[model samples]
Target chain A: MRTLFAAISGGLFGTGLMLSGMTDTRKVQGWLDVFGNWDPTLAFVMGGAILPMAVAWALTRDRSPLLGGSFPAAPDPRLGHNLVVGSVLFGMGWGLVGLCPGPAMASLSYGGPSVWIFTLAMLGGMLLAPGVRTRLDVMASAA
Target chain B: MPMDWIYGLAGGLLIGLAAAVFLLANGRIMGASGIIGGLVDGTGRSNAAERLAFLGGLVGVPMVIALLMGFVPDGAVTANPLLLGAAGLLVGVGTRLANGCTSGHGVCGISRLSLRGIVATCFYIAAGGLTVVLFRHVLGVI
Candidate 1:
């Protein structure tokens, strides 16, 4: 049952990637074009998604997430160095290869080899998470 | 381009299943980024069942789709492998610093109606948007 639901979610996300042309690195790259020959489609897609989600979050700060979980959903918006640093890292990658997890997984339906490389690297990143967290914790404590 | 509803349904199920299972069994959200980050951040995994299971579906489904549907990726794909790996790593690191991914914050957290989640999601969308502009437009990687 759990697997079923997760599959559905991934399917929806993957489908979105496909429909939006996110699976195509070139499309993503094209959207990345800002000033010259900027394809504003991606911005519109993102904006279309963000507003509703933002409103929902603002309204539901006190409520538990629909899915049962250990932690109550609460606003923990990071406005410090973390946000900028993380965003920069994320943007850097998004700009470079045009495949984030959501889209990368979606692209696999298309079966591109580059997507495979990304998937492996992403898994590697997941694997390295513990040590990084510890280091971050130590640094925060020291600071 | 119109998205196929069949795929949407499938994706939705995967996402929902991952979320429900992770939330119930592991007491975690089934955000791949967060799960991966937790592995890195030195914290004992609060729950791994749903995370692993959901992640598995994420990859497995694509292969299955290709097998079952005879889906072939477009022939024009020519991305640099090294760059792709770098992007993945950056995303992982970003998840670590942000404490959640788009799935976690954008979908689950926002659904729960948290302000911070909203902020996080905003940052995510904004970064992603600006990134397209900068790399694709300003720098022109190719």
Candidate 2:
């Protein structure tokens, strides 16, 4: 049943967040401190993640998505100023905040009440995404 | 054993499994960046809904699990709020510009071995490395 799958999936996902230390911004900040004491845990975690991910991608790329049902994979729109600008900003933000979308989503599993603050910021960020994209694109177009 | 480490592993397993299943059933790569990007371009509403659901699961289900398990993170604790806000905004902008994020380029794109994804990933890694160096070494935030 979809209900059973959903419940089970939710549990596993939450558990992963908690185990990965993503819930702790301190750990994240420490990891990002590349030249300063450089916690290497994130490396192992990202490494652990690659295996299953690779399996899934290889198996799934040619078929239709079960939930989305055969949605077409589009060609890359590639190569423009947006790429350069966006990546730079993303890196800057990650360097400063110690959390990005993936880790931020995972941190919610830690369950302290303040996690909500991070969540709100994340949602707010996501919502503002379109507008920001448009502005950047417009800037690119004019430039 | 640190509590957070254990929890993070569990979380990664969950995402991996879900990603696997989504791949099997939907035949879609679970690249949050790409899915989210498509929503912006209006090329994939269906992709958009699934992405929303996936994101919702990423954020909500974790807390729900913690609630049921009776082990909540302390204090709803967070870092510098302004820093997080700025970070999130910048990430949004960056993801838009890159045409994907770690999930898209790092996970899905890498899996496919796409040249573009490789280039994007390289850029992301380089930028992240430089940013870390800049913040800690050049700027001395650390």
lDDT of 2 by residue, B17-36 (tens): 76566556555555655554
Residues B7-90, candidate 1: write the lDDT tens digits: 433434434444443444334454556654554554636544544555556666665665787777775455677777877887
> Clashes in each model (backbone N, CA, C under 3 Å)?
43, 31
Q: Which stretches of candidate 1 lie over 4 Å from their true place?
A: A1-4, A43-71, A128-143, B1-30, B36-46, B67-69, B75-78, B108-115, B118-139
lDDT of 1 at A121: 79
Top candidate, metric TM-score = 2
True-contact fraction per candidate equals 0.33, 0.45
Best of the candidates, lDDT: 2
DockQ of each: 0.31, 0.42
For each candidate, the alpha-carbon lDDT, in order, equals 0.58, 0.61
TM-score of each: 0.69, 0.76
For model 2 chain B, the run of ten residues with the poorest summed lDDT: B1-10
